[model samples]
Target: MNSFNEEISSKLGLIRNTLSETGASAVRLRGTDWFAWATAGASNAVLLAAETGVAEVVVTAQAAWILTDEIEAERLQDEELPGTEDSANPLYKLYINLWADSAARESFIRDVTAGGKILSDRPTGDEAPLPSSLVKQKRVLIPCELERYRQVGRLASEAMTEVLSNAQPTWTEYQLAGASAQALWSRGLHPALTLVAGERRLPLYRHATPKEEPLGRAAMLVFCARGYGLYANLTRFVFFGSSQANAEIRNYASGHRHIREIEAEALNFCLPDKPLNGVYDVLDRAYHQHGYPQAIRQHHQGGTTGYLSREIIVNPSSSQTLAENMAIAWNPSLPGAKIEDTFIILKDGRLENLTFDPKWPSVKVEGRDRPVPLEID
Candidate 1:
C-alpha cells in the first residue's frame, strides 16, 4: 500500500479503538467508508437527489448504506441504482483491515461501495430494522487537521480580492468566476460553488451560474471555499455603472450596509453566558431591517466552522453554545443590490473580515476604509 493510504488506515484503526472506548457504539469507520460518503452523492445528485430521505448515509464499523426507500419503487423494481450496475464507487471509500484477520470491516466496505457484491446492504435477506441509537445521531466528520482549512479560507479571500481589482464593465460574469477559481487553485483551495450573475439576471437565483453573456450594471459572486474538511463562504458584488442605477437597488444597498452594521454589533453578543441563539436572533432582525422579511429560511445564513459547514445552520431555533476557538463566517447577503464580507467571529469579540473588497477603491464603514466594488462615474 502507498504510504499515505497506509498511514490513513492506521489512524482509522486508532479512531475505531478510541470510539469503541468513548463513542456511542465503539465503532470506527474506515477511510474507505469516508470516501464512500463523499461521492455517494454524485449518483444520487444526477438521478436520485430529488428523492426524499436519500440525504444521509449511515456509516458504522459493521455497515455503510443509504435508504433504498428514496430510490423510487419503480427504479428499484427495474434494477439497481444507475451507478450500481456493477456498483463499485471509488469515491465511497473505506478502510479494509488488510493487515488484520478481520473480514467484517473489509467486507463491509466492499459491500457498501459495490451495492453488496461482497456483502448485502441488509446483510441478510430478512428485513432488519435500523438501530434506535442511530436515530438521534448526526454524521459530521471532522478531519484531524485544522490549520489547513483556515489556510484555504484565507487564500480564497485573497484570490477574490485579486479578481475584483481588474474587473471591467465588459467582462462576462463567468469569466470573473473562472478567474476567482484559478486564483483559489493557485493558493491550494477547493471550489464548492462559483456563482456569478450579471445585472440582467439579478436576484433570479442565489446560486446563479453565469451565462455566456456580457455583464451590464452589476455582478454578484458567492463561493463556498473549502479545504481540510471545512467551508468558509462569502459573497461579493461588483458594479461598473454609476451608483444611481436603480432606486430599489440603491435602497437595498443602503439596507445591506445597515445589515452589516447589525452584524458588526452582534459580534460582541457571543458571550458564553449568552445563548448562541441570541446571535441568530440579531441576524434575523438585521434581515427584517434590510427589507427581507423572509430571509432566514431563504438560504442558510451561517453555521459552525472547523471541519466543513455544520449540519446545523445557525438559525433562530438552534441552541448550540458559542465555544472558544470556533471559527465562524457569518455572511448574510441580499440577492442583487449588495452583499458584504465573511467576518470571522473571534474569541475576544474582535471581527476579522475574511473576504475583503480591498484594492477596488474605498468607502468608510465604522471608521475603516472598506473597498467599494461597485464603481461609479
Candidate 2:
C-alpha cells in the first residue's frame, strides 16, 4: 500500500472510535488541515487558500471518500485513485462531495453510508464549540507527514536565507518582502505571512508587515512559508554597513542575546507531557530573569505549528499539554529583537529545529546555536 493511503487508513481507524463513542456514524471535514490529513496530501491546494467544491467523509466502519467537483474529477481519478498494486485500495472511495445543501447532504448520506442512519460533525453547522475530537488527532505527526515537513522546512529556510543574506541598505521593506515571497514561490513554497522591519521600524512593531521604509542599517525578515499543507515559521536579521554604525546596532545585538537566552529557557522547558502554560511560565520567568519581564507581553509568544503557522498559541493560562511528535514554533521577542523557528519534538522528547540552515551564519550563546544577525556590506 502507498504510505499516504496507509496514513489515511490509520487515521480513519482511530476516528472510528470517536465516532462510535459519540454515536456518530460519520464525520465530514471541511477545514484545510483536516482535509489534508484525510486525503494523505491529495488536497494541498486547501493550504494556499480556501476553495469550494471539495469535502472528506469518513464513516465509522468504512473507508474515506474524497469528494470533489467535476473539474477535478477526471484528474483525481486518473492520477490519485489507487491502482491494482495498492493494498489499501479498498479503503478509499472518490465521489463528488459538493452540491446544493439538502440534495448534496442527501447524496452524501446515501453514497457515504449506503443508507445508514448518521450523525455528522459539521464544523460550520449548528455544532457549538466546533467538535475537535475528529481533528485533534492530527496534532501528532506521523512518519509520512514528518518527511514532508523536513523537506518543506529546508526549502523555506533556503529561500529566507537567500533573500536576507543578499539584503541591501537601499532596499525598502516592501522590496525585501517581495523578494522573499518571490524566492519562496520559485521553489513552490507559499508565504503565509511576510513581515519586514527596517532600521527605522525596529522593535516598535512586533508584526511589522512590509512597508516602503528603506532598510538603512539593519532589518528583520520574518516568513511563514507553506508547502505540502505544512508550515515553517522563521525569522532572520540583516545589518547593513558596519556593526558599529551607531549605538542602536549594539543595543540590537544585546537584545538578541537576551532574547536567545529567554528562548533557550522556554525551549528547554518543552519536555514531553509538559503543560503549555508551564512553558509560558518559563518564558515569563526568563523575561523577568533576563531584565525584560514585559518583553513577552509585547507580542504573542508562538506555540504549536504545523499545517497552520500556529496550530494554537501559548498564553499565560493555556492548558494544552505538549506531546512527542508535535511541531512547535516558539517566538519570544523584545522591542528590537526576536527569535522564532519551527521545530518538532522527537519520540525521545528531544526538540528538532527544522529551520536551521548551515548556509546562514549563526552564533552560539550558552552553547546553543542561534542565528546571528546577518551583516551586509
Candidate 3:
C-alpha cells in the first residue's frame, strides 16, 4: 500500500481499537478537527463559526462511512474523500439524505450500527461522548501530517515577513490587521485570528484586537493561520522610531530581550517525558528572576498545539507531560513584550522550529535563532 493509504488504515485501526475498548458498535466524528485528522486533511467546515461541521464520519470495526446531506455528498466524494473510483478497498462509503430530513439521517445511522451503542465526539441524543483520552490521541502527528504542518508553518511565516517588513508608523492597527489577513488569504491560508497593537495600546491590553489607532512608533502583529486543518501561530513586532532616541522604545526593546531569555529557558525545559508542571515552574522562576514576578499571573503561557490552536494549556498544576513527536506553541508574554513560535519535538528528542524564516532578522538566544523586533527607521 502507498503511504497515504497506510496512514488512513492506521487511523482506522485506532478508531477500531477505541470501539473495542469502549464496547461501542461505532465511533462518530462530528468536529472539524477530527474530520480533518481522520480524512488526512479534508475539511468538513462550511460555517466557520460553528464548532461542529456539516457532515460526520462513522467508523466501525468492519467499515467506515460518511453521512452528509445531498448538498455536500457529491462534492466531498469527488474532491475530498481519499481512494480512487476503482480501488479494491475504498476508505469510506458515502451516505446522503435530504437537507431537511433529520429522521432519514437518524434511521440510516441506526441501521448501519444495527441499533448498537454509538459513541460520538459531540453527542446529541442517546449517544455517549467520546473520551478525552481518545481526543488526546491526535497529539502525536503521523508522517503525512508532519509534512503538511511544515508546509503550513513556512507559509504562515512568509506571510508575516511579507506584511510586517513593510509596516509604517502611519498605518492604523486596523490597516495592519487587514494587510496581514490579505497576505495569509492570498497564500491560501485562513486567518483564524489576527491581532494588532500599536505603541499606545500595547502596554494596556495583552490580547489586543485591532483598532483605528495609528501606530505611532511601534506595533505588534500576531497571527494564528490555518491550512490543511493544522494551525501555525506566531508573533512579530515592528518599530518605526530610533531606539537610541526614545526611552520608551529602548525600554520596550529591553523587555523583549528579557522575555526572549525567559522563552529560551522554557524551550530548553521541554524535554521528552518531562512533566508539564516542571516547565511551568521554570517559567515562574524565570519571570521572577527577570524582575517580572506578576507576568505569569497576567497571561497564560501557551502549550501543546495541533488540530486545535492549543491542544493543552500548560499551568503550574498541569498533569500532561511533554512527549516526542508532539507539536508545541509556547507564547511567553509580559505587559509590553511577548514572543511565540510553533515547534515540534522530533522523534530524536530535538526541538525543531517549524515557522523559522531565514529572511526575517533574528538574534541568537542560547544558541538558537530567535525572532526580534524589526527596526524600520
Candidate 4:
C-alpha cells in the first residue's frame, strides 16, 4: 500500500512540476495502450476511452464532441473524429447516471477522457481491444486484488441488507432506487445499473426504469456496484403482500434453480489456461441442464465480469475461455423473475459467491439448500 501511495505521489509531483514549465507544452503523457486502437480509430476515439461498455455507451457522443472540437481548434491536425451513437449509448447512459451530481460528473469525465486525449494527439486508427493482444503474458492473479474484492462484496451485501430493511410499501420506485444508490455511494462505490421493476413491471418491460409510483406489492431492485474498476452485481426482489402463488410460480422458481445448476456444471470443467471458447461450450449444457432447451431466445446470460460488465458475451458461438479469479454473473430470467449473484472462481475450482450474504435468501447449490430468498419479504 505504501509503495502504491509513493508511486502515485511521485507521479503527482512530476505532473505538478511539469505543468508549470514552459517546456511542458511538449510534455504529453504517454497514454495507456488500452485505448490505442480506438485512438488510432480516430473518428470514434472517445468510445474506446471508456472503462466499461456502459461508460462507452454514455460518453461516446460527448467524446465525439471533444474530438471534433479539438480538430476544429487545430489542436490535432492529424486526428479524425470517431463518433458512433450506438457505441456512445453506454457512455451517454453513464453521464445521465450521475443524476445531477457534480462530483459524479467530474469523475466521469476524468475516468473517460484523460487517457484518450493523450493518445488522440498522435492519432492512430488501430481499433484494438481495450486490453490489447500482446499475447497474454501469463495466467496471474494479484493477491491484494482478490482480498479487496472480498471486502467490497461483503460491503455490498451489507448495504443491500441495511437499505432493504428500511424499505416500506409506500416508498416510490425512484425513492427505493435512491436508497440503494446512497448506500453504495457511502461505501465509495458507484451505482451502475440501479434498475427497479415495481409490481408486475418486469413482465411489461424488462428494462423497467424507476418511477414515482409506490412499489405496489413488489420490486426487483438490482445494481452493479463498482470500485477500483471492478464490480459486484446483485439482484433482490421485495414483496409487500402475500407473494405466494397457486402452484405454477413455485414450479417456475424451482426450474430457475435447475437452470443455475446447468451454469454450474459448465464451469466445472473450466480451467484457467483454457481460452474463453471452452467456457462457451459449457453454457449450452448448463442451459439444457436448467431445462431451457432453447436458451438462446430467452435472454442474454452475462460473460466474465471484471474490468467490463461483460468481458465478452457467451452466446452459443463464442469460444472465450473462462479465466480463474474472474467474477461473473449469470442471470437467466423467465416471466416476471430473474436470478443473479456476483461470484469469483476460487483457485480450488469452486465458485465463491462474493455477493451472497447470510441474511440474503438462497436456494440449493451443490447438495445443501442454502438461505436464498426468492421472494421479497
After superposition, candidate 2 runs with Cα above 4 Å error: 44-60, 75-90, 97-107, 110-122, 127-134
* Candidate 3 accuracy as lDDT: 0.87
lDDT of each: 0.51, 0.77, 0.87, 0.53
lDDT of 1 by residue, 258-291 (tens): 6566555456565533566787888787777757
Query: What TM-score, computed on C-alpha atoms, does each candidate reach?
Result: 0.62, 0.89, 0.95, 0.63
Which model scores highest in lDDT?
A: 3
266-367, model 3: which lDDT tens digit per residue? 999888888888888999999999999989999889999988888889997788888887899988988779999999988776788989888988999888
Q: Compare candidates 1 and 4 on TM-score and give the better one.
A: 4
Ranking by TM-score: 3, 2, 4, 1
RMSD of 2: 3.0
TM-score of candidate 1 versus the correct structure, residues matched by position: 0.62
- The RMSD of every model to the true structure, in order and in angstroms, is 9.9, 3.0, 1.6, 12.1
Question: Any residue pairs clashing in model 2, and if so which?
Answer: 203-335
Say which candidate scores most in TM-score: 3
> Where does model 4 exceed 4 Å of error?
1-140, 245-252, 266-270, 278-281, 288-291, 367-371, 374-377
Residue 192, candidate 2: alpha-carbon lDDT: 76
Q: What is the lDDT of residue 229 in candidate 1?
A: 35
lDDT of 2 by residue, 1-377 (tens): 66765777777777777767666556666556666666665552533655322545444465566666656666666654543124545666766634344477556656656554454434443332224654466788888899999998999999988998777899999999999989999998878789999998986899998898798898999989887678899999988877787788989999898888889888888878999999888999899998876777788999998877788899978888888889999999998899988989887867788888888888876565779788876
